[model samples]
Structures are given as C-alpha cells and as structure tokens.
Target chain A: MRRRTPAESPSKLSDVARLAGVSLSTVSNVLNHPTRVAASTRTRVEAAISELGFTPNRNARALVVGTTDSIGLVVFDLKNSLFVDIARGAQRRARGRGYSLQVGSSDSDVEQQAEHLRFFDAAQVSGLILAPMHDAPESVDRLRSHGRPVVIVNHDPAEANVCRVLVDNEQAGFLAVRHLIECGARRLGIVAGRRDLQPVELRVEGAHRAARESAVPVEVVEYPVDGLEPEYGDRMGSRLAALDRDERPDAVLAVTDMLAMTIISRLTAQGIRVPDDIRVMGCDHNTAAWGGAIPLSSVSLRGEALGEHAVDLLLDEIDDPAGHVHETITIGPSLHIRESTVGRPTATPPA
Target chain B: MRRRTPAESPSKLSDVARLAGVSLSTVSNVLNHPTRVAASTRTRVEAAISELGFTPNRNARALVVGTTDSIGLVVFDLKNSLFVDIARGAQRRARGRGYSLQVGSSDSDVEQQAEHLRFFDAAQVSGLILAPMHDAPESVDRLRSHGRPVVIVNHDPAEANVCRVLVDNEQAGFLAVRHLIECGARRLGIVAGRRDLQPVELRVEGAHRAARESAVPVEVVEYPVDGLEPEYGDRMGSRLAALDRDERPDAVLAVTDMLAMTIISRLTAQGIRVPDDIRVMGCDHNTAAWGGAIPLSSVSLRGEALGEHAVDLLLDEIDDPAGHVHETITIGPSLHIRESTVGRPTATPPA
Candidate 1:
C-alpha cells in the first residue's frame, strides 16, 4: 500500500504491460474496459499495476494518442434547466463513445467564457461543445486555430464554417401560435423578452407568420419585456388582468415556459381562469411546464437532442479532422398540448 | 497567424521572458493577472508570445506549481436546481479566488461519480468538492489516498475524519412540521420519499420531534413513497383527496419542494383547496417552489450557502493541508411562508 513520493517518477502503462507480459492494448483494455479483458489476464495486470504503483497519466497519454478521452462543454448558464438537459444528453453520448464530458458554466459573462475556453485548450480536451454567448465567432475561430474540434450547441453561429446544432426556434414559435389559433382564438398576444436574441427573434418571426397565415382574421399583439424573469411575467399578467374582458387577448404565448408559468400563477391569483378565459402557451417545454399547477402547453425545443447532435458532430470532427466538413444541424421543435391551453376534462378521475 | 506544428515543442514562459528581455514572472503576470504588469512590458511580452507561438502547457505548469488553477465539483444530479445553485455559488467563489471550477453530474450513478473523481485526479485539480451518492466514504478514501484535497458536500459521510458540509435536514424537518402545527393543525402527515436516504430519515425524525413537542395532542401520519418523482406526489395527493374529511390530515409536509408542487397541482385539480382543506408544506425551498402556480411554502436548505462553504473548506485544505482538521459544518434551515400554507391574502388588488 506504499504510495509514490513527489520526487519519484510515476510508473507507465508500458511498465505494467511488460511486468504482466501482456500487450499495450490488453493493459489498456484492463484499465478502461475491464469487462473486455479476461478474468485471469485482468488479475495479472492488476497485480502488476499494484506492484509497479502505476497510475495512468492522462496528459502523457494524450501526448502519445494525440488526444484525451474527454470533451469540454461550455454553456452560457447552468441555472436554466435547458442547459442542464443539454449537458446530460451530451454526457450520455460522450460516455457511450468512450469519452467523458466536462461542463463549465460561463454564467453569461464574456470573460468567464474566454477563461473556460482557455482552460479547455490547456487541458487539451479531444474536442469542445460551446453553447456560446457574446462574441462567439471570435472564440470559435480561436479554438479552431488551435487545431481543436469545436461544436456549437443551442446556437447557430454567424460563421457557417464551424459545426453547430440548434433548435428551430422559428418553427417552435409557429407551432405554439398555430396551436393557440386552432383552439379558437381571434386575438393573440406574444410575450417576448430581449428582442435582439436570435432565438427570441426567430420565435417572434414564426409567431407573426402564424398570425398572417390564419384562415380567419386574427390580431397579433407583441408584449415586449426587458428580460425573462418571472417578475416580468407577473407584471404582464397584472396588466392583462386589468384590461376589460373584451379588450384582453383570448390567447397568449410566452417566449419561455418560466414566463408562462408565472403569468398563469398571477392570473389565477387574480381570479382569472386559464383556458376558460384566456388560453396560454409557451416555448421550451421545460420541467416547469409539467410541475406547474396548470400543466403548461409549450413548444418542445428538444434540448437533449440538440446536445446529442452537437457531440456527434464534435466526435466526427475529432475522429477525422482531415476530412471533416463543418455543418449546421437544426433540430425541429414540436408542440405539447396541456391543460393550460385546453381545460381539464369533466370526466370522473381514474381509479 | 502561423501556428506551430505538433512536432514542435510548445514555447515556455521562460522562453517568452528571454525573448522579451524580461523576467519569467513578468510573462506569467501578463498571461494571468495582466493588470499587475505594466502596459509597455505587456506589449513586449505579447510580441514575444506571438513570435514564439507560445501556448501555456497546463500539465507542465501543474507539475511545476504542484496543482492546476481549477477545482472539480461532482454532484449527484445537475437536473435538480439545488445542485445547480450550489455549482453557481462554488463557481463564483472559485473564480474570485483565481481558480476555475469544473463540474460533473453523476446522475446518482456510482460509476459516473468514480469516473469524475478519476478525471479530476488525472487533471491534477487543486481540490475537489463532491456531493456524493452510493459508497461515498470509500470514494472519498480513494480520492484522499491519491493525495487530492477533498471536501464532501450535501451529504455527511460515515467517516467523520473527512471534511463535509451539509444542510441540517433534521432541523429542516422539525421547522416544517412545527410551522404546520403553529398554523392550527390537529392532524399532520409527513410525505416522504426513499426512506433509506439519510436526509429523508433525518427529516422524518425531526417531524416526529416536532409532534412530540406540540402542546395539544397531535396525530402524525408517515406517508412513505418509493421515490420523489412528481407522479408519486400525484398518487399521494389522490390518496389524500379520497380520504374522509375526519380521517384526512389537516396539514401535510413533503420532503422536497418538487413533491409539494405536484401535490398542490393534483389536489387543486381534484377540488381539494390547499390550506383551506389541508395546509401543505415542503423542504428544500427549491426554484420550483417560486415558479409554481401556487407559490409554495417550504424550508430552505440554503444550497448556495452550502456550496460556498464547501469551496471555503476545500480552499482551506488546499492552502494548509497539514494543519487542516476534518470538520462537518451543518447549515440551519429556515421557513418560507407563502400562499400554499396560508391562503392568498384577502386584501384587494393593489392599484
């Protein structure tokens, strides 16, 4: 059980393989995929590793293999469940492909994003998946210039030469508004935050298109907010509730499920029924939608799918950098119908 | 920008300093804390870096400095907002201390947790903060044996010799049940999930203590579930709704906010008015409580504070490993009263 001192040089995989009288790949299989190695051979390798005190040095291995079995994921915010879902998806895919995913939250700060990128670069991760914010193209260029495989997730970068995966937000907005219209709505309201954001802009565009394509004449009103906090939704809800019954929009679609949940809460608190009076819908069918008192109807952005696709693209580039072609993959959004838009059934409860 | 080929050895800080006719520290300062170095010297160092195609090798730097400028955090579940809050707090603290935080989600898997620990070990992180699950003590031992400074978070380990930070779950349970009694409850029910979990057991114990301390005779019912999923909450809510008025508990306390939210949603759907028919409360005052249709009343675990404290302990260990004593710091929980426990205010809407 003696441990190596700082002054002593560490044993290598080669030393363990030589002592165990096994091939290098056999020793590697015993270390990484133990089930792939036979019991007797694995025991012999283990005894040799114990005798040699061999701890695999990832950096040295990376130098030999040209890459490490790790991928770095940089996201704007981890507080948002969407990013967590994406990380989970990416982690599962990476693990399946014999790679580990390391996550760093930029917290929406440009400096933090840059620092994470630098750290990942220094770590020499096999590849990187960035859900970027604020001056992303420059960051991507910097990473690419360093000969690192990069995959942009949850965003369509301005540069088309890099691999990217994003949810079709415009289609998400279209599906949400179209669903509301189908539920017999003439007046529609779109609750939006930060108009300059690409996803927000695309969703707004889709909403407008939905309004324009309506068979019956429909009025679409945009309620813009500074940000997507629940307080903003509460303010909007209070304002909506203050309006006369006839003046209020018959249907509303918040840009995100969080805003929609807050709005529903506020409206319900003020004695305003959800679907009975004004139907409501949201995008990013996040966990909040299901856990809310009124199950929220929302457009699914498919965060996990976006994450998995980003990793797929990253791995492809990592495996064959010479023949890699950068591509932008867009995942289509789907609609989820729930009690918020459609009132609960009057039938007896299930036994 | 011409890049060096893989065949060429990366430039060292000493080489950059020599090229710039400056000290090594000056080159280091320019790369790290740039404001500390003079602008003229920084420009010269930048020119030297560009001319030499310098890329700092983190592994080599770690070998020189004995550690990397990073901390590793392994959490049971990043999907839970509580863990995310902890990570956010730890990241901010680490960044302020000139360290980067790398996070990995175990998703309640033991092998995943072990993988993260191994990855961090390979990366030579300065320290580690682990929110462990399944054989945590052995895992912590394995990490400590590797000469890594470790701080356990969210879970108090079996080995008291290890540094750990956790919420006072027993006190959390007691606070929740005490609040219910103060709100005039004669019959109380504790809605718990996964009885084997230490936190759940502690909270239940605290609930019993609260009932014993009540002046009036109170009946405490323990309603145990297989797990904490929303569907389990729904099932429990239905069971409660089906009970006779005289048999039903006047107040119920769920182990987590997520369960409380789902219960509220299910109860309201079944014409069982919360607080009016049965006052309900929860522990872990997570974000779901605030975002729910009925703002939930619960006990706050102070996850961010837990995270921050974990980092502080980790840093202390890293700085003075020889003098560091193993300590278990437990943060007290507080109650948040909202519309769920007490019905919405009767006051008229504000102008």
Candidate 2:
C-alpha cells in the first residue's frame, strides 16, 4: 500500500465517481440510496471507495441530517467496573445499530457533568445516556427541549416526563440482608456511604425493611462512611474488630463490592475469619468480586442490562420524537452467593 | 428559568447580535476573536449568549476550522480499570487545555478498533490517542498521512516515525521476578498468557534476564495460558497444586495483576499459603490488588502517566504539526511489594 502524503487531501465523492467511471449522482445514490443504483454499478462504486479510501465526512452528513450518528454516554465515575461494563454493553448495542458510542467520565463532579452534557449538546449527538451523580432535572429538560433524546441510566428521577432505566436498588439491598439472615446471622451491620445519595438511601431503606420483617430478633446497626474508598472500609473493619465478640455484628453487608473486599481483607489480616467469625457480603457483584481471596457474595446490579435498555429507550425516542412517550424501566437484582457469606463447599475448583 | 420548546432552534449568532444590539461581525468577533471586540460589546454578547442558551455548533465550527475542540481516545478494553485510569488522566489534561476528550473502547477486537479509527477520522477531531491491541503501522501511517496527530499509548510500534508512550513491560517483568528472587526464591514459575502478545513476550524476556543474572543457580519454568481470564488462572493454580512438592516452583510471577489475584484466590482455597509456602507476584499493579484477601505485590504500569504523556505529545503535534518531532517515550515500571510476595510485618492495620 502506498502511503499518501500529508499534503494530499482525503478522497472525495468526486474522486470515487471518477475512479468508478460514474456520474456524481450515481455515486451519491450508491452511497445513500443504494437500492436505486444497479448492482454492478454499486459494486463498482464500493470497489472504488475501498481503493481510494474514501470516508464520508460524518460532520458534513450530520449537518445535513440535523444529528450525528453518535450516542453520548456520561458516566459519574469510570473507576468502578460497573460503569465500564455499562459502557461496553452500550458500545456493543450502539455499534450493532450502526451508531458510534462516545463516553465521558464526569469523575463525580457536578461541574464536569454539566460540561460533558454541554459538549455532547454542542456536538449535536442523536441521543444521550447519563448515569447521573445527582438528579439534575434541569439539565435533562434543557437537552430534551433541544430535541435530543436523553435516557437516564442507573438512576430514577423524580420527574415523570423523562425516560430512565433503573435497577431495583431497594430489592438489591433487601436480597443482601435477607440472604445474610438466612445464613444464620442474627446481628447485622450495614456499611453505607452518604445517605443523601438516592441509591444508598434506597438500599438502606430496604435493609431496614428486611430487619423489620425478619422472624428472628435481629439487631440492625448502621456503619456510615464519608465515602466508599478502601480506607473507609478499613476503618469500619477496625471499628468492628475492636468490638467485643458479643457486641460485633454476626454479618456485615457493604454497599459496594470494593468496600466489602477491603473490609474482608482487613478482618482476615487482623486474625478474624470471614464466614466463621462474621459473614461478609457486598452489592454490585462487580468483576473484581469473583477473583477475591474469598469469592464475594453480592447482589447483581446488571450494569450491562441497564446500559442496553437505556440505549434502546434513547434510540426509540430518537426515531420518533413527537410520538415517543416517556417511560421508566426498572430492572430487578439477584443474589450471587459465594464463599464470603457461605463457607466454600468441598467440591470442584471454581471455573 | 423558562422551558424552551422543541420547536425553538438553538440560538444563532444573528439572534445573539440582535439581542445584544451589536452587528453580526461584532458577535462573530466576540466568539472567534474576543480581543477584537470592545469590553462593553463583548459583555453584551456574552450575556445574550447566556440568556439565549447559545451553544456554538461544534460540527459547523469543525467544518470551518478543519478540526473540532475535541480529542479522541481509543482504548483496547474498557473492562480494565487501567485503561479507564488512562482515559481519566487524558480527559483531565484535555479539559485543562480547553478541549473535551471522547473515549471509545475497541473491546480488543481488530475490526472494532478500525471502526473507531474511522469514526474519529470522520469526526475530524483535533488529535487521537490510541492504546492499540496490535501494532498496525499502516493504520497509524494512514491516519498520520491525513495530517491528524496520532499518539499511540501503552504500545510500542516497530516504526520509529510515529509518536508513542509506552510502559516498559520488560522492566515490569524484571521487577516482579527480581522482587520474588530477593524474597528467597530459587525456582520461579512465570504464569503468562499467549506469547504472541508483545507485552507478554517482552515480560518473559525480562524474566529470563532476571533469572540469568541471579548469582545462585535458579530454575525457571513457564506456565502458558490461553487467555487472562480467571478460569485460566484457576486452571493454572490447580495444575501447580497437583505438581509434586519438589517440582513446584518456589515463587510465581503472573503476567497481570488480575491473573495473579485469581491464582492466589485459587491457591488459598486449596490450602496453599501465599508467601509462606510459595511467594507470588504480578506485573501491572492494578487497583483490585489492594483490596484482595492477600494484598498483591506487583509492578506499576503507570497508566495515568502514560495517558498524560500521550496527550501532551498529541497536543504538541496538533498545535504545531510541522515543527513537532515524533518520539517514543518509555516509562519505567517500579515494584510494589506487599503480603503476596513477603509476609506482612505485625505493626499496624492497613489504612
């Protein structure tokens, strides 16, 4: 293959037409209205396109079409594999539907989130999928008013007019606590982060409900942290380890898998057995949970499903703006029991 | 704030000029060349822009300026938090330079990577930063031939004409094995993925160098796996467990932190104590290694630094393509010793 010089411009439609010995309109028909062109002519045009490496300018097409064949996904944080999984899922689905997915991480900053939203708006993307840090109804409304479809992922906004995809976080919490109770835990400690966050609040709510409904007299205690970092988990673990045997909770459920993994590591390092002393579990069933020393028991958040569904909803609205009716889709969570909660059964090695 | 209807188009320069009681040229100058406009006129134009919610169309601007105020970053996989960290670093740096960074994950598919490269080309972004799965010099050359600044990250291509930022995989391998040897290991087992991969091949080369350089005669064994999944790690662990006590290596070095974590988990499940019986270490000190049941000792790939340097090189080229010189910058890896390689000192709990 001969390398083209920097001074040489990219092959244009005219270049393709000239190479294929076809008129300009014929080349255009071959690209856009392919059915209108004869098979032989279309093949010739395609061969010419491949030979010349002619790539139609998406920006130029977007100007004509009023929207780009691109979807923007704004995630709160990319550090968590959950968001990464979501992006992977969204990207696959977007590609399958002949669109490119571009992602931006806001890093949990509200200002950064606004900047990303604005950038996508300026880009005039066909749609957006947002995993918001906070319920920014105004931002959603502003984007929607500009005729861009928006789908909120992993969040349920209070506004009824917006489309959203949410995991049943309450159900996730309920499952985690209920599983702990079933594992013979009478006292429970819920390691939670900021209560103001909707997911955290909802999970805590469901945990309390589980405690209230338990047949056994369970003492439910809450261990709050400023954030969900490993250091915070280490602190919680130290505080729990310091308690008298009778005062310590029989089991602990951390809000996230990372936190749970850290707490379990801390406990084990301090001479405390995992399931033997205090059972441990986490939420989000993250990829890291599977490879931990004690395989983590967690509630599955289904990040991939959330991402797929959000894109589905956004595309549906983009295809028919006026006729589209806003809807909120809720996905249910499930439990993944592992050695952290239940001692490893003597059997085949994990696959 | 009044809600604008979908029928309303985004505010244009004409609208801003009209509202600000300024000429169209003044409005254009205020946006394109702010210093060309008087302070009072600029303030009026800015206020009009704020009030009318004017977002300059990036696509239109790109057509005029030949590039958008955006940079494209294509990573091999989003599933790896290392890539995510790189994206985060690139984004922060790009944002500081008044540009938005858009990321696309190729998911380790060659076709997907080509598609992303094409997408960015059509988008006509200011520059591109890619962490390629395979060294495709032709693709890089083609992109560069179009006058687009390309900075390859985490991979060193054989071609010296392109700019690249790379972590020294050979050094990473040497660091892991040297640490294991320092901790009193006469025999070493390298758990690696496919040898076709450049990083794997380079790491193995460094591991051999370390073994050869050892003062005492050291035996080295290679345990090759099909892939880096946890299942592969588990299989490797089981195979090593079944080996005769004298046949098994005194220490093991996995190619990746993820693989090492899984191996440790599997070994511990089968009653093999890390460090006490066989020391274990890994290359690429990933974030998950910190919270594992046994804290993993590995080599730091410095993903963030790689990303930051890639962007710096890209932006420098984009700013002055003719004046820029292509350079391959190598980043050396450092060892991070933890409990997996050496028994923890009994002082204080992990923070």
lDDT for each candidate structure: 0.79, 0.78
Candidate 1 local lDDT, A1-351, one digit each (tens): 458764565565556767898765566557555896799999999999899887643344444554438899999888777888899988887776667788999987877888788778877778899988643887777888898889888777667788778889999999999999999989999999977778888999999999999999899988888798889988998989898998999999999888898888788788788888889898877664444556688887877877877776776677567755666767788888877898764432432
For model 1, which pairs clash? none
Best by TM-score: 2
lDDT of 2 by residue, B244-264 (tens): 889989999999887888888
Chain A TM-score, cand. 1: 0.78
Please tell me how candidate 1 rates in CAPRI terms.
Answer: incorrect
Q: State which candidate has the highest lDDT.
A: 1
Report the lDDT tens digits of candidate 2 across residue range A274-340.
8889999998877654444566888888787678767766766775576556667677888988778
Candidate 2 docking: what grade?
incorrect
Model 1 clashes, total count: 0
Candidate 2 chain B, poorest ten consecutive residues by summed lDDT: B57-66
Indicate the worst ten consecutive residues by lDDT in candidate 1 chain B. Answer: B57-66
Measured by TM-score, how close is model 2 to the native structure?
0.74
lDDT of 2 at A48: 94
